[model samples]
Target: MELLEERIRRDGVVKAGGVLKVDAFLNHQMDIELFSQMAEEWKRLFAGKPINKILTIEASGIGIAAVVAHHFGVPVVFAKKTQSINLDGTMYSTRIQSFTHNRIYDVIVSTRFLGPDDHVLIIDDFLANGCALRGLLEICESAGATVEGIGIAIEKGFQPGGDELREAGYDLQSLAIVEAMDPATGAIEFRS
Candidate 1:
């Protein structure tokens, strides 16, 4: 987690509208070595929990979830933002608002990939508004899967999402929590 915080300080950029662009090393372009390290941290954090599968929203979260899944020796199931022709059968779906794109999407997961027997670990890159993770939680609930934990790469602590989830009794772990950011000065303050 210290490694992630340092990396964020060194490479993360503060943008207007409370956006922290980490595309240079996360989200868009990825750092697999760093991700592997993060996976180890998450594995340690969720040790002894019954985590049979890793769930995440499509796109940004897929990379982190995949790497983390490898550490847990579980398959990663990502909720697709859009339904595709290849998808079939009943699906668990929910509407999610994107923190970055600022749009709402009907996120879905195939019923075959998740079910009542699964103990799921939800992973994602950022927890801004918590909408994406909330939607994923809905899908898991619809499938009757027990949520083991939630792992986040970077949490904007200045936002309400992380606190809300914690108050809701989720076992949430975030590697880096940005307590505040200054778009004018490009300074980021991390929670101690």
Candidate 2:
């Protein structure tokens, strides 16, 4: 986690409107080495849990989730933002608003992949308002699956999402929690 915090401090960009762009390394153009390291951290942190599956929203989260699934020796299931022709059957669906894209997406997952027998570990790139994760949680609920834990690469501590999830009794582990950010100064403060 310290490695991730250091990377954010060195490479993360701060923009106005409370946006922190980590696409250079975390999302857009990924650092597999960094991701592998992060997966190891999460694997250690969530040890002893019955985590049989890794769930994530499509796009940015898929890469992280895949790497994590490899470390956990579990299959990764990503919720698609749009239903495709290849997908057919009973599906668990929900609506999620993207904080970065500023749009609503109808997210879905095939029922065949997840069920009541699965013990899931939800993984995502970031957590701000918690909309995407909330949607994934809804799908898990609909499937009657047990949520073992939630692993996040970065979390905005100033935001209410992480706190709300924690208050709800979720084992949410965020590698880097940004306590505050200054757009003008390009300064980022991480929670200790």
Candidate 3:
């Protein structure tokens, strides 16, 4: 986790809309070595839990989820932002407000990929308002899958989402927690 926090300090950029762009390593042009380290950390955090699958929303979270699935030796199931015709049968769907994109998305997942038989570990690139996390949790509940834990790469501690999820009794682990950020000064403060 220290490695990640240090990386964020060095490479992350803060924008006017409370956005921390980590495209250089965490999300866009990725750093697999760093993701492997994060996967190890999450594995250690949820070591005893039965995690048979990794769930994440599409776009940014896929990269982290894939490496996490490798660590857990499970398949990655991403909630698609759209319903594709290739998916058959009943689907778990929920509406989520995107903090970054500033729009609502109907996220869906084929029920076949998740069910009572699965114990899922939800992974994501960032946590801000908890909307995305809540949508994923709803999908899990609809499938009757046990949510073993939640792993986040970066969490904006100023945001309500992370605290809300913790208060709701989810075992959420975030590698880097930014306590505060100032786009004007390009300054970031991390939670000690």
Candidate 4:
């Protein structure tokens, strides 16, 4: 977690409207070694949880989820941003508003991948407004799958997303939590 916080401090950029861009190491060009370290930390956090599958939303979440799944020894299931023609009729869908892109997407997951018996761990690259996390939770609920835990690469502590989940009694772990950011100064404050 300290390594991730340090990486964010070193490479993360602060933009207007409270946006913290971590594309250099996280969202865009990934640091696989750093990701592996984060995955190991997550494995330690959810050590005793019955994590049968790893679920995530597409685009940014796939790579981190894949790496985390490797540590869990489970298959990764990413919710599609758009329903492709090859996708079958049986699917669970939810609408999610993106804090970064400022758009809503219909996130879909195949029914075959999730079911009542599954104990899922939801993984994502960032948590801001909590909309995507809420949407993923809805999809898990639709399939009757239990969400054992939620793992995030970075969480904006200034935002209410992570706090809401923690208040709701969910086991959530974030590698780096940015408490504040100023675009003008390019200063980022990480939660200790």
The candidate that wins on TM-score is 2
**Model 2, position 15: C-alpha lDDT score:** 96
Model 1 residue runs over 4 Å out of place are: 83-89
Error of 3 at 78 (Å): 0.6
TM-score quality measure for candidate 3: 0.95
Task: Name the lDDT value of residue 113 in candidate 3.
Answer: 94
Give lDDT for model 2. 0.93
Displacement of the residue 23 alpha carbon in candidate 3, Å: 0.7
Candidate with maximal lDDT: 2
Task: Residues 146-180, candidate 2: write the lDDT tens digits.
Answer: 99999999999999999999999999999999999
lDDT string for model 4 (1-192, tens) is: 889988887988899988888899888899999889999999999999999999998888999999989888999999888633354678888888876676878889889899999999999999988999999999999999999999999999999999999999999998889898999999988888
Give the worst 10-residue stretch by lDDT in candidate 1.
Answer: 82-91
RMSD of 3: 1.8
Decide which is better by lDDT, 2 or 3. 2
| Candidate 2 to native Cα RMSD, angstroms | 1.8
lDDT of each: 0.91, 0.93, 0.91, 0.90
TM-score of each: 0.95, 0.96, 0.95, 0.95
Of 1 and 2, the candidate ranking higher by TM-score: 2
